[model samples]
Structures are given as structure tokens and as C-alpha cells.
Target: MSAVRENNPVLTAIQAAHPVLADDLPPLQAVDVAELAAMDFKPRQPLLSPWLCSQDLAMVFAPRGVGKTHFGLAVAFAVATGGPFARWQAPAARKVLYLDGELPGAVIQQRLWMHCPDVDPAPGYLRIFTPDLVTEGRTLPDLSTYEGQAVIDAMIETDTALVVVDNLSAWARSGRENEAESWHPIADWLLSLRRRGIAVLLVHHAGKGGQQRGTSKREDLLDVVIGLSRPKDYDPQQGAVFVVEFSKARNLVGDQAESIELELVVADDRATWRCRTVEASTFERVVDLANEGLRPNDIALELDINKSSVSRHLNKARANGLIKADKAARS
Candidate 1:
């Protein structure tokens, strides 16, 4: 039998009968079963099992510096090597393919060695995408240049069961994420990969309005939508906690409950992340004050950062504080 016949009997049979139905044959280019599938697979359940037990196409959306990369790396290492995730019970370990679109290869290596020494990150198992750029600096493919199909092909070749895309914001072409058509290609590509049973975890930034980034289509394309937020039920310093909630899950059990807390810790030059519950209460208070009487630009000036940074941080801080905010005051 031919290779196609040996691999896919259905395709082989269809092709074999093609000559008989030549008169009724449709243009191959016009035939789009995949596109039809993509349109219909809006609410998919590709990822439902906890941890490594099942393949999951999930996303984590949060503001910057909220530890999405660190959190993802920890989870990927645990899944790759099979151990507890930051001390939580984890599923069986397997090889993980991490596509670091934002961080450099050297930075990624340093992070893994410093934070996850237990993980035996061999070249075969833990892969990195560090194509050379310029003599002055090296850079990975940005969102506009990144092709999900290419990454998928690499994953299949490497037998990677788990894949992580750090910061979807960086991987996607620059534009208004609210535009549906702009994200269609990336969404469709991700869907095609998810159908092949690879667990893909992507990190993205939550929007200014405390919403997930990208159009509603992005959420529809994902099997699991997980949100990271600080607990607004009380003052963060009263042990104000960070939380992980299953914003959407096809197979997971339980109410959208708090899955984990952001452990607050300081790191030195080693890129080490340590967590111990700290008082976000003060931060929350600052945000509440800002929302009530302080302008965002003023707050940013006080914090010595950009207005956009202040806006993002304030959204999260107010969220943690559960502060009812007025648009007029912030304006």
C-alpha cells in the first residue's frame, strides 16, 4: 500500500474513487472542511483533565508583572519532569516544548536552572526557539512573524505533549485586539493544533476594563479560559490573596473557584521567584484612592511610570480591593 493508504485509509479511499466521480469533483482549493470545522468548534473541550492527565488548550490572562511567565514555567517544568507545581500536587511528568517568544534563550536557561534545578532540561526534551537576529542582539519571531503551524510542526517532531506560549500579546500582530477578523488566523491555527491533541497554554494580558484580551473569538477558540485575579473579597494585606479561576472549562469540575494565590516574594539578580502571602492591602488602598480622587496620569507620574502602566496596575489593584470605582474620578 502507498504511504497515504497505510496512514489514512479514508483519504486513500477518497482519492482512489476520485476518477470515477471526476465529473462531480470539486475544486480542491475550494473545499474547506477545515474551515467549516473551525467555524463550528467554537465551544470545544480539548482541555478538561487536570494537569497532565489530559491535553488542554488553555490561556492565562492577566496584567504585566503578575507572574504569568514564572507561573507558566513552573507548571511546564512540573509537567515536563513530573512533580508538584510550586508545591501543589501535579500530574505525571512528560517532555514539554516551551516557545519563549518574549524572553531570550539565555534568560530562559537561567530561569530554569535557578528556579527548576530538579528538572533535567535536556536539549531533546525542553526546547527553545532562539534564532539569531543581529550582532548587537538576538530576538525570537515576533507575533506578526510567528506561524502557529511552524510551532505545531516543531512540537510534533519533538514529541512535545505540552507547549507554552508566553505572552500572547507579543505573539500576535500589533492591533486592536477587539477586531475579530484580525485574530482569525491565529485562532484558526491554534484550533487546528488543538484538534491534534497537544496541550497548548498561552499567556495573555487582561484588558484595561479587567477583561481578557483579544476579541470574544479568542475565548471561543480556547478549550479552557483561566483568569488570574487578586481576591477582592477583602483587604489584600488581611492576606489579600491572588486567585486563579476557571473562567470557562468544558470538563473541569467545581464552581469557578479560587485555584491558587499569588505568593509574594522578592528575588535578587538570579530571576528567582519566591512567594509568601504579602499585604496587597496597601496597594489596594492606593488604587482605591486613585480611582476616587487621583488621576491615572497623576498616579503614574507619582509612581514614575507610564500612564498605561498605572492604568493596568490600578485595574488590578482596584479589583483586589473590590473598590467600586467611578469613571469621572479617574478621568
Candidate 2:
């Protein structure tokens, strides 16, 4: 009946059997089957449904100049206002803290104004920390170190539910990019934040290989990992056309996992994005070989995906009537 999430079964059993030792027993430390099942812990609520949940850890990575900051700021605004951000909507407005190590104060202000020209943001609801605003020519604290974390931790108000770290390269400056061990401290810090019921969204840069830069170990503990890539037919003139794909989604399935083809149209002195669920699988590479009736193996080779994924997509395409089952069988 206690509201606390404390969960230890052996000690609980001892206290239940003998009330005399209840006061002397230490706090609960573990969860047993029955106790865990009976506990009244509530499910974590989403900041952005189907992706970011309370107490969750997530990341969005993209190549340089691919709109990582734009995406991060939009997410921050959406969470702060409880808004409809692309396909996701927050249940309610919540306090958010956004830390940016790269952009200037004027640039950020411009971006915020662009997002909401007529409406004023709720006061103190979305706190921002930019390197330009730091006092006495000091830089924003490095998130990879304890001292830096302490500084940022002090900046976070108790009511703040989400913290956005814009592009890890600038904030987490202490580590070697490719060394997995270099990211351990930052990873632990992120986990600690998650344990405290604070959700974190890390904006990141993509590597030369077109994936999240640095150690893959970072994804090992994350609840969601979004990768933004310019489409295969991407043109420099095309302002912001990127594919949003989930590389690691814990509970998402079926349509929830489909990649999004997002385009930002800037005209009439305004900027807004449009998104649609892509028809093909996330692995599709637009190969000329795929145009012909090729076997799954050949298609997989062209798509740079494994045989199993090719088979799965082929089945899904057929089931959705996007492709003919007979044609697939012939391939």
C-alpha cells in the first residue's frame, strides 16, 4: 500500500511475518516475482508517444548539416508545449531543459521565434543553457565529467521532466569518439538521470559510415535510437529531406517501426516539416537490380541488408498488397 517504489521481497516477507523487526529492517533492495507482480508501479508516460517515454533514454543522430539541431529544438518545443510534433504528440505540457553547446544565443533565439512567432512560451517551462550565455567567458560544462554534470544538475529544476542534449560532440568533449570505454562515464550519467525519472534526448552526429558517430555501445542501454539520413536521391537544393529510421526501438512493432520520409519546406517567411510513412522497408537502397524480379538474396545484396530482413519485408509488402505475392514468389 506504500506509494514508494521500493521493492525487496525477502525483507518484506520477514516484516510481514514478524512486525517486531519491521522498524529495524533496512530499505527494500530487490523485487521478487509475486511482489513485483503485485506492485502498483504505474507505466511510464510518453513525452512523445511511441518513441520517448518518461525516465527513458534516447538519441537522434544525423550527418552534419542534416538538421539534428532543428529536430532537437522542435522536440523540446513540442514537449514544452505538449504539442503535435510531426507524427508524435505529448500528452501534456511538461518542463524541459535544453542544453546547447554549439549555437550562439542569437541563433537559438531566432530559432525559437521561428517556431512560435505570435505565441509566447510559458515562463520558466523550457529552460535553455547555451554556451554563449555562460558568465565571464566560461564555456558550457562538459557532460562527460562529474563536475560538469554537477553544474548542469544544479541548473535542472526539480519539475523538469526532459533534458535535451544538443549534439554530443560539443557537450561530451572529453572522450575519444571511437573508443567504447571513453563513453562509459557519460553512459552511466545518462542511466543515473533515467533512474531519477528524467528523460534524456541526445542529439548526435553521424559517422563517416552514415551511422551514429562513435561507440555502438552507447545504443546498448538506450530505449530508442533514431537515425536521420539524407535520402538516396538527396539533392543539395532539396532543403531538408531526411529519412527518420529507428535503429533500436524497445517495444515498437509493425507500422510503428516504419521509416518516415520527412521534408522541411521553407517558404513565405516560415518553416515547417511534412512527413509520411515510407512505402519500402528502411533497408531499401533503390537498386536497379531490385527493379527486375530478383530473388530475395539478390535484393538483400543490393539493399545492403541481410537475407532475413529481405524476406521479412518481402512478406510484409505482399501482405500489405504493396507487392504481388505471385511476383515475389517468382523472384
Candidate 3:
């Protein structure tokens, strides 16, 4: 009846808009394994070398106040300019549309100014839309529904190579984060973007457990998931300092997925970025944990790493004289 149809928002929206429904869409194409292999599909080139690529769906997440926005903006600027960002290098300049949800207009403006004083984006190459840009009578569209998805889709141009959504909480307003099905509409929209050869960078929040917040379903379709963790003994005065860890990566292994420590230092009138790979063999963490009086088992638990890794790091710490024989025995 009318009441039942009204209860389904998507169906109502489609009816009102007179658009094709899901059932009306064409069937998915399929081919034999050999036909699929020999389809002559173009190789996906790196958008950011070794990790992010053309048509990639990637997510970068960090706990609140851990510089997720800073990292997101840096990547956007680099890709929009075909420049270097920390350790990642964009091979060439491409069009980008950065959609900001959380920050105030003046704040994002100042940050962009700090990062680029004179270098401007190429004409039509980089565009930005923030919540502050919406008129007083209008609100930013949510990405959790098909209607919301269509509104944002209209903003994306054909030439736009990347879309940076920073981030879920602000942009996707109605979803229940813990429910996997609640994320479906948004996930399907993101996949549709990938099918159109557009890459997406999702900046999300990390839960107290230091993992991406919400259902793991968000990561099911992602090609790379980068985690930003605040350094222990972190100094509040030192803003935007964190270690970048790639928890999930495709087509990469070993050093390609190594963690990098990055710091943003803005002294005088200029800003500078510093980055370096964390040395795995140093096992400096073992020394720190031992000095803090955490036993090997506790250390492994706290670090969320295997006990074998704890043992190996402890051995390395001992070899480096970071732990005395007696102290090492107890730790």
C-alpha cells in the first residue's frame, strides 16, 4: 500500500525522482576465467607510489586529535600538484575534489596557506567543497542514502581523478557505525566511483583500541588501510606527529609496507615535513616497554603483536645492550 511504499526511503526516492530502480539495472557481466585474464585491461598505475593506485579505494584512519585531517590534506595537495608528500610521491598532477566535513572554513584555509603560500592549484585541477560553503538554508548532503549519494555524485566531474572525504562521521550522518548493513549504501557508492576509474581516500576515526572505528565491513572493499598512531611520550606542543602504519595493503609486502614516522614542524614563517622509516631491527620498543616494567606477555598484549615478535625484539634489544642480562631475564 501507500504506507508500505512510504516506509522504504530508497523506493520512495526512486519513485519521486522517476529514476531506474535496482531491479531495472542491467545484469552484471561475466566471462570465463581465461577470457577475463586476456581482456586487455589496462594496468593500474600508482597514484601514490607503491600503495595507492588509480581507481583505488583506500582508507586512512586515526584516533581523534591524531592529525587525520593534516594527513588527508597533505595527500590531497600532493596528488593535486603531482608533488611529494612525506614519503609518498604522486607520479603526475591530476584533478582532485576535496570534500571537507569537519573543519571550519577559516581553519582549512589557514592550513592550506601554511602548506602552500604561493603555489596555487592549476585551473580546474583542484576544487574544494566544505560544510561551511553550504548556504544557510541548505545542509551538506549525507552519503548514507542513495539520494545523498546522487547529490554528491553531481558534484564530481568526469576528469576528477580523486575524491577525499574527510571523513565519515561528518559526511555520512545517518548510519549506525557498528552495523555492517548500515554501511552498504555508502560502500556501494564508493565502489561505483572505483568502477568509473576514480580513486577515493577516506579519512576515518580510530576507536580506543587504536583500530579503525566502526564495523570492519568498511575495510572489506578497501585496497589500503593506513593507521596513524600517536607516538608514546607525545608532546602536545609538537603538533601533527604520528607513526603511519599500513595494516592492510594489496600488491605490496615487506619494506613496501613498512611504518613511517612523520612530524610536521612549522617554525618561523614556514612549514616543513619530516619523515623516516621506523627501523624494525632496532627493537627500541622492547627497551621502552621493559623500562616501563611491562613483562613480555603484557608487552605483546599491549602492542597487539605476536609473542614471537616480542621474543625477537627482546633478543634484539639485548644484543644492542639496551637491556642488561638480569633485567632482560625478568622482562
The predictions' CA RMSDs to the true structure, in order, are 11.3, 10.4, 6.6
What candidate 2 gets wrong by more than 4 Å, as runs, is: 1-31, 38-43, 117-120, 280-331
Per-residue lDDT over 139-205 for candidate 1, one digit per residue giving the tens place of the 0 to 100 score: 3444432343443353344356677887777666555688988776676556555665567888888
Q: What lDDT score goes with residue 186 in model 2?
A: 89
Per-candidate TM equals 0.59, 0.75, 0.79
Candidate ranking (TM-score, best to worst): 3, 2, 1
Error of 3 at 77 (Å): 0.8
Candidate 2 per-residue lDDT, tens place, 4-75, comes to 313644234334433336568788789889998998764687888878888889999999998888888888
In lDDT terms, which candidate is top? 3
Candidate 3, poorest ten consecutive residues by summed lDDT: 10-19
The Cα RMSD of model 2 versus the native structure comes to: 10.4
In angstroms, the error of model 3 at 186 is: 0.6
Q: Against the true structure, whose TM-score is highest?
A: 3
Instruction: Supply the TM-score for candidate 3.
Output: 0.79
